[model samples]
Every structure is written in C-alpha cells, then in structure tokens.
Target: MIDSSANSPIVRLVGVEKKLGRQKVLKGVNLEVRAGENMVIIGRSGGGKSVLLKHILGLMQPDAGEVWFRDQNLVKLSEEQLVPLRKETGMLFQNGALFDSLTVGENVAFPLRERGNVNDAEIRSEVTRALKIVDLPNQEHKWPSELSGGMRKRVALARAAIARPALMLYDEPTSGLDPVVSDSINKLMVRLGEELNMTSVIVTHDMVSAREVGDRIAMLYEGKIYIVGEPRDVIESQDPIVHRFVNGISDASDAIF
Candidate 1:
C-alpha cells in the first residue's frame, strides 16, 4: 500500500537454511524487507515462522546463508558485535512476556533503564509517551496481573517501542485475543509504524490482520518462502496451496502425520 518500491531493504535473507535436530526448518529461504514498510509473514502452526524472525534478530543463526541487517551480515557477527545492532530493533513476543513482578511503567522503562543513558525523569516521560501511543495513558501504576489480555499486549507493545527502534518484530501478537481486541491491536500496529517510522516484520496467522496492516505479505511453506506479493495479489492467488490456506479450506490429504 505504501510506495516502498523505491526504498532499499532494511533486512535481507539470502539462501538461508536452518535445521533443528533432524528437522530441516528453513530451506534456502530468501526475503527482503524494505525500510518503512510493514511485512506480514504467514504460515501454518510450527512452520518455522518464529525461527525466521529469530534469524532477523540475530537471536538464531542459519546453518547456511546470510542474514543481513543494513550493510552488516548478522550471520557473521559475534554476539558481542551484535549488541548495538540488536538495540536498534524491538520485539514483541507471543505471550506479551511481561514480568509479573514489574509494574506497567517499570516494564516499559526497562529498555531505557538498561541503556543507562536516560535519567529517571526522562525515563518516566518516555514511558508516559509510549503508553499513550499504545492507548493506555496513565496506566503506569497498574500491575500486569491487573490488566486484561489486550491491555497486557498493549503494555508489552509500549515497552517494545519505548526505545523507538528502527525495526519491530512481532510474533503472533493477536494469537489469543477476541476479534474486537485483535482489530484494536492491528490498528495500533499500523499507527506505531507510521508514528515511529519503523519497519515491521509481523508473524501472524490472521488473514484479516495481515491484509489490513501489511504493505506486502509473504507466506512460508515447506521450509521456503512460498509466495510474496501485495495483499490482494496473495489473497486472490490462483495457486491451489495459497488459495486453500488463505480461504481456510482444508483437504484431508494435507495432514502429513
């Protein structure tokens, strides 16, 4: 939807391959995520979507191939070397992953606190701003336990974006929420991408969310990128595999177990 055709890729994966135990997860997968665009990744459960994201974050390295973030190849970087680069990115886990012991404000301030550059007043101000952006203004005193599932997610989002990372990675952000909550989260994601000037890589199974938030969608299937295109192009695809998955149509033969 956004004109990212002229933008250079902020993330690039070339012939990326990975294996867990005996299972080959990624097979020569290639993808390009342009700066300032929202890229949605969709695939079946346990289909390596999370694995692919880890590679981009340099949390996991591929058995073969290159994972490039900007001009640096993440695959070749030592953990020490990857520290600064990792700081430039934000990630929201599937479970919201908030610390039960920390208050909402403390949780959101965690990143800036770790950096140790911002003073207490600045951290408080940044926390307030991030929480406002996620639509949970003045919720600083609440504990994670006191909030609803959606609220927890919003808080986690606030924490992730507090540092204003150039890239944001989301893992099944709407997994357990109700439809209404899911829609709200999707809207917040779009708003954050615009307001923060972030390039996002979202891993999700929600077709509606994908279409609404993605400038482009890429489907990972059988250990490779099955297809990538605009929302309409992918949704209206004639390929049987894509059609079946997108339309939620199931065939008995698809069950490999």
Candidate 2:
C-alpha cells in the first residue's frame, strides 16, 4: 500500500464543502498532505475539525468538490471500490472503538480478519506485533474492560496500524492520556514519519502534541484553514486571529468594538 519512492501528495482535498442539515460543517477546504509527511490540524471545539476527518475517511461524503488520494478521486468511488483505498488509510478515532466482547488480541485482529484474507498463523503473528508496537504486548488476552484509558488508546493505535497503512489519520490520539503518555504518543508519531516513513494527519486540541509531531501545522477557523506552515510560525504569527486563537484571546475579530 505504501511505496516511499513514489512522490506527490498522498492525500489531497480540493475545494471540498460539506453540510449537515441546516448547518455548514466545512466550507471549501483545500489542502494537500505529501507522502510520509506529518500534518497536524488545530481548531476550537465544534469548528468542524471532526467532520473534516470523517470526510477523508469517506464515512461522510462532501456535498460539493473532491477528496482525492493522489490521482484517485474518492468521491467518485463506490463502497466496494473504496475498500482497497480505505485499507491503505488507517484511522484512530477519538474514542477507541474496541469491541467490548473481544479480548485485546481479538480487537486488534478485528480489522485484519474482516478486511483481509490472511492465514491464522499470520493473523496471530500480526496481532502480537501490533501489541508490541504499542508497548502492550502483555495485554493480548485481556478484555477491553480491564484496560485503562491510556491502554485503550494504545489498543486503538495498534489496530489502526496493524495493516501498516500508507496514511494514518489520528482524531485526538492523545486526548485522555496523561502528559507522560501523551508525550510518548507524540514521539511515536514522529518516529512513524521518520523511521517507518508513513504519512500522518493528526487532529488535536493539545498544542504540545501539535508542536511535537507536526512537520507543518494548519489551523481551521470558520470552516477554512486560516493558517498553514511550520508549528512555531503558525503559533507565533502576527496574523491577529492566529495569535488570539492560540493564546486564547477572546475578542471577536468578526465584530467591531
């Protein structure tokens, strides 16, 4: 699924727009993430950050414009046709979607077994590797209910990465974890890009996470990417809104005092 030698943007969103009922969730989003790049997006709550992630995952389609994977336009593909493309992109949801009925190994094995035709021995081997990658190799036989919040997140990460996707989309990957655990996840993200050469798109509220893992940072405000560049550049910008948003300046730029 991943060929590092192939160059070009692995994922691109061109003039994309989406609406939910009477509300507009995204307005003409245009962005591109190149191969093996780590792009982090930051935005206030309810600012359509989550909605935009869903669009790329094809969990929801845009009402207007295109979501592309290099040359393949995802918007035009049927459910069956999109399967292979999806397999190349792994999504770590905000809430780890673990099957409570299954053990940690089974949960990690879920995607592989459902979407792949691997043999039983290979499946077990892959499951062990995934757990080891997350530093949870000992939790293989434990149920979801037995794990802590951080452990659950690690399990989700393991599952998303088990297939060794070309692209990894993380939705609040470090949300519920402590500073130490969050820092570990951040370092792992950096390693994924540097060592494994995997492209990553991360949506996060944690500014620290943004700075740690991002090769570049983009901020979404009013349903558009208001700023895009190096982490410190975007965070320390004189673009009043950028400064205000990052530093929590509450004055309304859309309104005149």
Candidate 3:
C-alpha cells in the first residue's frame, strides 16, 4: 500500500514538452509518481501515452523541461550515465516484445544473464519464482511462437518483474487482450507491485484496468494531464470532457485521428 502523504517521488516530469516531426505530443506536462504507488495514464489513441512512457525510461528526451528519476535528472544523463539508472527500472512493451528466438525461461532469465553475476542455479531459481508469480510455473521450455497472446503477455510480465526493479513502466499492458485475460493481467500487475514494492507507471486507455490497478488515475488530453485523482473520482467525474472520455462518448473532432 502507498502512503498518500509520502513526499518521495520516484519519477517526476516537470514542464516536459516533446515533438515528433511537426506535431507536438507532450506539451509542458507535469506529473509526479510517488514512490511505491501505481499511477495509470489514460488518454485517447495516439495521445502520446507511449511517448510519455518512453520519456520516463529515458529512451526519449524531452525537447524542454526536466525528467527526474529519484535525484538524477534523466534528461541530463548521457547514455553511459543512464545505464545504472535504466537497470533500476523495468518496462513491459505493448506487444510483449519477447524475442522470438528465446524460450519462455530464457526470456525471463535475460535480465539476470545481462547482469552477469548470478549463476545458472540462481537464475533458474529466480526464473521459476518469477514464472510462478505470473502463474506460468514449469512452462519455461515453450517458445514464444507456441504461447497464446495472454500467455505471451504473462511471460513478458514475468520477465519485467524478474529483476525486481524499483520502478516499472507498463505500456498498454491490457491492449488486444480479451476481457478475462485483461483482468487477470491487471491482477498480476497489482500483485507484482505489492510483492516487489515497486512504483509503477502504466500507460493505457482501458478504464476497467485503470480502476483495478491504479491508486491514482491521470487523464492526458491535448498534450496535458487534464486531471489527477483517485479512480472513483476520475471515473465519476462530472466534467463533460472527462465524462465523454471515461464513458467512451466520441466527438466528431475525435475522429480527426
């Protein structure tokens, strides 16, 4: 559980702005993800949700303002300087991003291998525990091609959590999943956040999953965070803009792309 009064923010974006080509994605966005809390970022399709996640990961630098992880300013760090900080964070891509050449076990164990200190015995043990956490115990030998979409997502979750990073970033974790599978994934995310004591930032448009996993929900609209509040408050919002979004009431302007 997160302490609402906690002053520590594991990640903080202050006046962040970004542009891809001529279109601006993030426009002076400011947000704070308190340590050990689950923060869900929700918005319409192509609304810069994934771009925001990339900024958090230091995979993309903001054109202006600052992105801070703990005391380190990510925007100021070089790739070499960012390595240790990157290791302290884990991310689940929207597509699972598992290597097709690797087995499930190998995939889960990739981080450990990259660290290069853990022995095979410890890697096997940690892999087993990680897989079990995702409820995929003893199925490591299977290739990515052999797994269902849901199973692939679960394996990706296992791999993301195996490192026990201080922070986790999930991009569209429940996208393309059936309702049942999405719920299961949501539960797993919550469980993993608790077990790992991680601060999580999940970028997704799924309100059900957002309500299920987020301690706080932030709605991104027109390149800004329109609101940040508890799940009930955001979902039950009376504002027309938020209401239209949360209730899926589309506007003609929303059809612009």
**Span of ten consecutive residues with least summed lDDT in model 3:** 1-10
What's the distance in Å from true for residue 78, model 1? 0.6
Worst 10 residues of 2 by lDDT: 248-257
* Weakest ten-residue segment in model 1 by summed lDDT: 1-10
List candidate 1 stretches off by more than 4 Å: 1-6
Error of 2 at 176 (Å): 2.2
Overall lDDT per candidate, in order of appearance: 0.95, 0.87, 0.94
Off by over 4 Å in 2: 1-7, 252-257
**lDDT for each residue of candidate 3 in 1-257, tens digit (9 for 90 to 100):** 87654558989999999999999999989999999999999998899999999999999999999999999999889999999998999999988899999999999999999989899999999999999999999999999999999999999999988989999999999999999999999999999999998989998889999999999999999999999999999999999999999999998976856
Q: Which candidate, 1 or 2, would have the higher TM-score against the true structure?
A: 1
Q: Can you write out model 2's per-residue Cα lDDT over 152-221, one digit (the tens) per residue?
A: 9889888888888889999999997999999988887777556556899999989999988998899998
